[model samples]
Target: MSIKLDQVVKVFGTQRVLDDVSLTIAEGEFFVVLGPSGCGKSTLLRLISGLEPLDGGRILINGREVAASGLHLAPEQRGVGVVFQSYALWPHMTVAGNVAFPLETAGRSRSEVTRRTEECLATVELTRFADRKPADLSGGQRQRVALARCLAQGASTILMDEPLANLDPHLRGAMEEELSAFHKASAATTLFITHDQREAMALADRIAILWDGRLLQADAPEVIYRRPRNRHVAGFIGQGSIVTVRVTAAEAGTAHVRLGKAGQDVACVADTQPGTAALLLRPEDIEACGDEGAQLCGRVERSVYRGGFHEADVAVEGLDAPLMVRLAGRPAAGERIGLRLRSGWLLPA
Candidate 1:
């Protein structure tokens, strides 16, 4: 089912937690809502699940309004399964019992419930541990049990709220792959909430970025990463440098922007009128050079080797902040180096 939100707003007393956010999730797509803590990501999920009431606007499922004008469908009638940050498996029930409990409650026959439980166990590769209790299972296995239970309950859509946050690094990676495989196999519309950019980039077909309780931008992963709409979007999505500069000239294909206090002209590719702008230079786009080559003069303050590459903290003149440049080789302190700024995005200052 395609989920749609139209000018959705949630208020707590006088505080507006979600501010007129609207978005749509395509059927069978891995849709991710990404933002930091207290950004209303979880609140949005709760509203979708019917766990909370919407203060304003409408929510539609399959083109039918589910929440509008203070009317909402109950959580049980939503046909949506929610996986919490902590796996919500019953401690007293065995793995199979946990999976079977939901089906049994839905008025299914004993044989049907048993069959479905076994199927779910096999899907999550937890068939052998069907007789084990929740405390006996590993953290990852317990999570799979929660997913299996959701499946057994016949959920057509799933809402996962930072589902992998509690696992170790290795287990988290494994679960990511497993979740991707499951989504492909099940073909269920998924809404995954996370603050980690790598997780969102790795899993989402399209990402909806939220900040300050508003929907900032919703686009494909690569487009949002490459062409951020504003400084907030660029800074929130990934690592980059936003340097303020003045527009010396403007044209269709290119513009000349002055950088630093001395006003060094840097060529910029722009599609609109150029004025005061901020240039987003990624670390990978900057190359280190000697006194020769097209170089911006800077003095290296410190250097650190990060596995495959070296990062140098260089103090550039006329700029308010120091420039972080990734180099092919390590350049030590007191070393004079030059930076070659290659490709970057220019935003209005």
Candidate 2:
């Protein structure tokens, strides 16, 4: 199913939860909406699932209008299934019973429900655990059960509101793989909501960054990470530092910028002009090098061991913010180091 939200709006008393948000999710696409808590991520999912009525704008499913101009369809009529963070399964029901509940409630024949339940269980690889109850399953297994129930509902579009938020770190990693495989087998148009950037980056075909009730940026995972549209997205999506730089010249998607006292050429948008602008420097953009070939020099203010690497913050003379660098070994505080700028993105004015 394809989802299109045109100027979608929601409000609670004096607060506007979602302000003029608009985006189209392609059919069978795994689209993720990423934002911090209380940023209307859950409200967006609720509106799409028909749990909440829209205060403004329109929602379309497969080119059919579902919510608009006071015309709100019920959840059952929308043909979309929602899996929430709590994994709201009935403790008394077995896995097969839970998967078959929706079909049976819809007045389907017993044989039909039985066959469909079996098929859904097989798809999630939970056929062996058919008789197990929700309380008897592991966190990951319970999540899969929730997914199997969604599939059993015959929903073309699946809405997941941080379904993996309750899992342990190791289980969350394993469940990500399971969810990917489940999406492939089911071929559902998935609209996932999460505050976890790692989860969003791992599973999404495209990611939309929502902040303060506004849609800040939406693009492929890597594009949003490398070339964020603004300061908010640059800081929210990944670890990096935004520093003011003077763009001396720009041509062919490259910006020759002066970072403090050192000059370097970095990646920029086509329309970037020569002027003062903000530049985003990720850890990978700065490199430790020999003093002879160094483009810049700084003293390490702090370093933290990150398993295989040491992330050091280097303080240069003229720059206000410390430049983050990844080193193979930890360097002592106040130690002078030679650095080179390999690449960076110039934020648009």
Best by lDDT: 2
lDDT of 1 at 292: 78
Tens digits of per-residue lDDT for model 2, 1-349: 8999999999999899999999999999999999999999999999999999999999999999999987999999999999988889999999999999999999999999999999999999999999999999999999889899998999999999999988999888889999999999999999999999999999999999999899999899999999999999999988977888889999999989988788999999989998899999999988899799999899999999999999999998878789999999889999999999889998878
Model 2 misplaced stretches (Cα beyond 4 Å): none
Q: lDDT tens string, model 1, 55-121?
A: 9999987787888995899988888889999888899999999999989999999999999999988
State TM-scores per candidate: 0.93, 0.99
Q: Against the true structure, what is every candidate's RMSD?
A: 2.2, 0.7
Model 1 ranges off by over 4 Å: 251-254, 261-270
Model 1 lDDT-worst window of ten: 261-270
